[model samples]
Target: MIVLDYPYVSKFLVESVRDLGLPVLDTPQVRELAGGVPLDYIDEIEFSARLALGGKVYTNSENGLEHVLRCRCNEDLARQVDICKDKALFRETVANLHPDYRFLRVSHAGLSGLDLSDFPVPFVIKPARGFFSLGVHVVNDLADWPATLEAIETERAALNAEYPEAVVSGAEFILEQVIDGEEYAIDVYYDAEGNPVITNILHHHFLSAADVSDRLYYTSARIIETWLLPFTEYVRDVGRECGFNNFVTHIEVRVTPEGDILPIEANPLRFAGWCVADITNLAWDFNPYECYFKELRPDWDAILEANKGQAVVMVIGDLPPGTDRESIGSIDYQGFQSMFSNTLELRKIDYKAYPVFAFAFARMDEPELARLKLALAEDFCRFVKMK
Candidate 1:
């Protein structure tokens, strides 16, 4: 059963749900979001029965998580969700796996008075329960502390107002050591038999060390070839440790230069937060949702061969800081697409309601690494107009 909840839902997911004939958990959001589109919807009672029978579930957004959690009849399912959602609990749950990793959870109020002299420096700090990198900041030095705290303080109240405490909160934050390595995001699920099956993996490309924005992520034959088994096995162990199965998860990790894989954070029951999971379909000709529903493992040998030396990139057209959304007249999507070597798909977003101009998918050859770099450095403001 699928739960369609707030923030955003992609057109591809809606079409996938209909084609697969999966039952959606009926709610007002279904009527509002799907409108007259045909769908199979199961109510709370029916959903509960499916859980009792070990039916697998998926959600398009974390905002819908509360509904799924509230109606689930299994205690283990709820525990899995809680452990994945709360960063503090997630760290503790996997503490033994990396006993030397440093992390501390502090309330929002305590941040101002906390002493940082003995605390870990060059760490990433963000809301304990965060989404979309709202309060995330990387401290490169002790001198950046006051500015970081001030930024969080200035943005804290708005964070609470903009989202449900369930989806995102400003009550507490987690400080942890920064793992230095190329980062990747995985869209994987534990099958009914409790084995992890990975569908797609994206290499999250950043402009610099201090960059935390979801600006650029790309998947290629090379990315899958490099990290597939290592990530699958790592996540499988984490799932086994947490007693998880019959679910979908989007995980991020940083691999050290020594070839060490450090678990960053896992988002349970969803993929890549919005419908960015559709990049799996765009890149590899398979829907991530379909993999979870049908319990199918992708034939990577064939897929990588077909996509050898090719890269499909997901770019988030993030709005520049302090841009007045109220004065935004339009986004020049055409001008934006011109930056890439070969454009695959471009999705224009409703900036008044959300934080981005668009989500784009592009295909590039190895020689186009320079093209990806150009796109990354492209001033999004050049493509946006003010009223």
Candidate 2:
């Protein structure tokens, strides 16, 4: 069963839900999006009963996490959600996996009075239940605290109103040492037996140390062959830690200079948000939703053979903060599309309700790595004519 909610849904997902005839939890948002699409829609009562009876579940966005919590009758599943939702709690559950990594949690109201004399410089501070890069900041110097604090508060005010607290909590925050490495995102699910099957692995690309934006992520065949087993094993360990089964997660981690895998966080019950999971189709010719719902696992050996020498990228054209959403404007989507030679898909989002303008998926070769760097550095506001 799937429970989808605001702020965004994708055509790919709606079609997949239709094709598979999966039972969708009936809600105005899902009805608004999936109505007349021939989906199997079920009411809350039936949905909750099915979930309690051990039905496998998936949600398109964390915004739907509220539904899961309310309908949750399984204490173990609820515990898993808590461990994944609360970053401080997550750090505790997995402490045995990395005992030296330190993290501290403080209430939102307590951040200002908190003394950081004992904490290390260059640490990351973010909402304990953050999603996307909202409210996430890297503090490099003591002088930057006031400005960073101001930014966090501004973000907190918006988040507390804009999303469900279960999705992005504004009350509590986590401060942890930065894990320096090339970051990677993995989309994997554990079967009924708790064995993990990876669907996709993406490299999170950034322009510099202070960059926390999710502007660019790309995947290739070589990455799958190299990191698949190690990441799968790591996720298996995490499942054991949480007693996870019949679960799906999109996990982020850093591969340190010394080749250590340090976890960043995990977004449970979904693949990448906002249909970034669809990039799996653009990259490997299979839908992640189809894989999870149908319990189908990719034959990695055969997949890597056909997917070599290609890079499929998920490029987010995020509108900068402070852009007036109601202002009259026109976007030069064509100008952005012209940057890629082989565009796989271009999804224009409702930036009026959400912060992103578009999600562009493209296929590139090794020589075009510089082009991705250009995308990473883009503000994308230049393409917008605000009145």
Error of 2 at 321 (Å): 3.1
For candidate 1, which ten residues in a row score worst on lDDT? 370-379
Clashing pairs in 2: none
Candidate 2 lDDT by residue in tens digits, 1-387: 998787778888889988888999989778887656878889999988888888888988888888888866766667777888888888888889999997899998899998998888889999999888878999998789999899887777788666777788879999999899999999999889999899999999987899998988999988998999999899899888877888898989999999999899988889998878888888988888888978999988898898778888888888876889788387789987877889988988887877778889999885687866876686777777787
Candidate 1's C-alpha runs over 4 A off are none
Q: Model 2: how far is 297 from its true place, Å?
A: 1.6
RMSD of each: 1.4, 1.3
Q: List lDDT for all candidates, in order.
A: 0.86, 0.86
